[model samples]
Target chain A: MHFPISDVTINPIYLICLGFFVGILGGFFGVGGSFLAGPALFAFGVPMNFVVGTDLIHIVGKSIVAARKHWTLGNIDLRLALIMVAGTIAGIQVGVSGIEALKKINRVDWVVGLIAIVVYTSISFFVAWEGWRTSKLPALKSKGKTEDQSAVSKDKMAFRKFTRWIQRIPLHPRVSLPHSGIKSISVWAILGVSFIGGAFSSFLGGGAGYIRMPCMVYLLGIPTHIAVGTDLFEIVVSASVGSFQHALHGNVDILIALIMQTGAAIGAQIGATLTQYFTGPRIRLAFAPLPLLGAGLIIYGLITGHHTR
Target chain B: MSRSRDIKSFLIDLAVYGVLVVAYFILVLQFFGGWLTDLFHNHRLGYAIVAIMLMVTQAAGLEVIAHFVLKLVRPKKP
Candidate 1:
């Protein structure tokens, strides 16, 4: 299809297929799918600005599809998600303004890319190691272990001591999220974590779910399934804000987003349904490689200065 | 009989989404072609508001459609 806004003549089939593949991953992981889609769009000759903007547009739509499916399965923690939004919005403003300042200094490209590569690589390896360790535990072999409950319990013990220590801080106005099974967590703690996620999202120009999902499970002690659903819910709101901002800046190609979303909607449904068949640890294990892939892509971009925009 | 009903429901759901998507596209094009340009020229904030409203409407509408389809196609438990 010839998308005039980006002035790119690409096959619609390829875009649809890309959307389908990313949609499945996004639905399963609660991400914006930009780590995969952004590079592919750049490779297809779309400008970097348009790639980010258009990806946000598709992400908003795709997230809605995925989140709805997850909601049907009772996976979303609406209370937590709503609370996080306040911090996320504030963080996004800070990140965006910081980037604008960096741009004025003419160091936004390589500096940002290098930091992204380092951060993505470190986090990816850590998540992968944790997933690998969990997968090897004897608890994984427990009989008829639906939802990997035994494995999850064992994993909880490892992080439980740390969480307990953090929970002891005399922070006021602690909130309890029953859906996520979190008994009590200070509102400040939730906002602090959400702010960092939102900052990474705006700075890296990606959905930030890669960071937030793991944090929800590991730090906030939310279950993996609920984290995925809540992440998607967060993505829907953040991506909507991002797409609108990008559109105002004349960066989005609405036609491309519209076409890609058609495939993404279908693929998201399939991916969300497929999650019902997998255990929580198994899902985490599968997610471990995606960030590594993103890290590798950023490194490649840094080295080649290809698609640096 | 159940299988046929499920298929019929799926088709109807698909048709509904298709209609909504088409309507959404028309609305976007109409707004962009008419008032949106002027709004943008007058105030960037106005453009941002409209753009957000449009995007949110599209996303919400698509989510509703997707939820309906998923409900229709949910696997039957034995």
Candidate 2:
């Protein structure tokens, strides 16, 4: 019997092993493991579309696990989740269409590549900045850590000023969430971020968290754990929708998705469990290298014209 | 006393499952392509078929493991 290979289909065993390792990394770092998933699938001769589509599907399982774990830990801010999801879904849609439009003019790949680099660097810098601040000013750092979990900070004028600005916007009939202190946020902002998240999920198949999680934490004043949970929860929607859209275009490979998702699911469990061992910043720091490496690889792929095996 | 509430909760649960199922099928079809086209266009649907099998098996298998872990840690209500 002859085995079929794509431009770069490594052994199935390799894919499974990679999934396991990436799963651990994701769990340890609080990411969806798409950073690893995309490249692994690519190595297996999966087309860019399938790599992305399946990667999104793969993320769903892990996010479910992570979100549940966070919820149980009382780290989930339900209201903030809803708001970020709203933004992420909307942002992703616009991003997807924007990609499509760019494709017509034939520069989609480069545009996306550039955006990914920028997003990657920005997230890296944010994480690094936090580390820098902590090292420089222990007093200032300790206050921001989740360890200082007091009721919403009244003294943090910056937080209050930003949050007040959010409140002043006319967002009536704001959706309140269960067990969360956040009352509401602008639907427009939610839609905007969601659309961008959607586009990222659609195009790259797994970068939504990089965008949505941060937006929730910084712009929306959501706690880091909640942002992580909600971001994962929201990916289920974004990925599913994007996957369905891709399937309509006939790009999904259920069998491949199944295999990788299997390894990924087990990995997710381990990953979610691992979250208990590390603080948000520590986890972020630990996993920081993966995205930086991934970005470099993608740039190499682009320059080499080697998207596939 | 709470039949109405139970019904509403059930309905919501149903909606969530419905959405998940629909989303799953849609995703499967998108990345793998429709069965007919995949068969015709490439004449090599075998890889895709195997891939789907791998993903589904992994997901279901892990869920079982998770259930076991959950049960071991906190037994389900009888």
Candidate 3:
């Protein structure tokens, strides 16, 4: 109940329950559940620094469980995850610097919060529209479960033509990821997307999987299932680096992290397994509103001037 | 699997998980609490490594046990 590392006295049961709930979201959506967990922890009297840093370490643990499950289901593309790690770390630095710059200008909270709201809202609407449009595709609805199953298990995208165009860029150092069904995609594109993901991680807080996962699906042309798995793989590495840095700075409470992870372990397993029952687009559709929820929170904070995290 | 069978398997998994959780709290958290708290104050580098190590090991270890239990409870159909 008393976490001496952060010097916070909190209920262990609350931490466990929160971890379980967030773990489900992380496992199901391939996003760090920090959007919920961060605010909740702050409300429960965990220091903001510990909330952010401890959450990163917690993410690493949960993602490991979820990622392993996805791996067993043949969903991970290791090559893709490895490449993205490099860009992600670099982008985090840039994002951190951006935060400092905004702080100096005395507009850090408003500017950053507004930007996040716009980004989150746009992503929600875009994904919702895309998911809605694609759910109506003739190939999916015409027949019964067979046709629907294929479209669900695999990917069928409304933005296929644009994705194909992005894929056709003749960058010399192209990489082939046959597992993701991406043949000869420019390495630059992968780095660019991951770099943006990393930027969002540091800038917006959490793993920024909400942005990165969709980028993988729409821009890199990866299936939603693969993107979810691969994103978790990427999170395991990036969040480790982040948590370590936060630990060095005395922001992490390992005891708290460990306790939370116990509940997360179960939730992650259930979340990852449940993914197999849904289609790619349906996953995206379900994921759409999470960002909106985040946006609503930011808007609440902006109006009230009562920052949650 | 049928929905009912799936629910039955899930219920069994939850029971097994509940037991493991109690054991973990009694054996691991209770024992390590003092040492980990000492490490947090006196040895941050050690604490950081241990934090990551503990989280990863506990998570992976628990998942393995849970997965095994799940498999036993939900035997594959021929």
For all predictions, the C-alpha RMSD in Å is 4.7, 9.7, 4.4
Report the lDDT tens digits of candidate 2 across residue range A1-309: 112222244564666566667777775665666765675555344555556656766765555555566667877665555565665565556645664565467664466666666666666676666544434444544676452232123234447676557645676655544454556666665555566667677777774677666555555566666666666666655565555554443445554555455455445445655565566444555656676666675566566553321
Question: Candidate 1, residues A85-202: lDDT per residue as tens digits?
Answer: 8888777777666655665565555566567667767766776776776667664565666445665677678888877766555698899899987788888878887898878776
* Candidate with more favorable, higher DockQ: 1 or 2: 1
Q: Give stretches of model 2 more than 4 Å off.
A: A1-8, A39-46, A70-87, A98-108, A140-159, A171-173, A269-283, A307-309, B1-61, B69-78
All candidates' TM-scores?
0.75, 0.70, 0.78
Q: Which residue runs does candidate 3 get wrong by more than 4 Å?
A: A26-31, A96-140, A143-158, A168-171, A269-309, B1-5, B26-28, B68-78
What DockQ do you compute for every candidate structure?
A: 0.30, 0.08, 0.59
Docking class of 3: medium
Q: Report the alpha-carbon TM-score of model 2 versus the true structure.
A: 0.70
Write the residue-wise lDDT of candidate 3 on A1-309 in tens digits.
Answer: 677777778999988897887777766765667776765665566654566577778778777866777889988899999999988888877766665566456565676667767877887898788677666676645555543354544454556877898898887689999999876898888898999988877666678887888689877889888998889889889878777766766667777777777677667657766877764666778877876886776666556553222
Candidate 2 residue-wise lDDT, B17-75, digit = tens: 33443455446546644553445246444544444343434455445554554444442
Clashing pairs in 1: none
User: Can you rank all candidates by DockQ, best first?
Assistant: 3, 1, 2
lDDT of 1 at B44: 62
Q: Which stretches of candidate 1 lie over 4 Å from their true place?
A: A1-11, A28-31, A47-49, A69-79, A143-147, A176-184, A223-226, A246-251, A273-289, A296-309, B1-43, B63-78
Q: Which DockQ-derived CAPRI band holds candidate 1?
A: acceptable
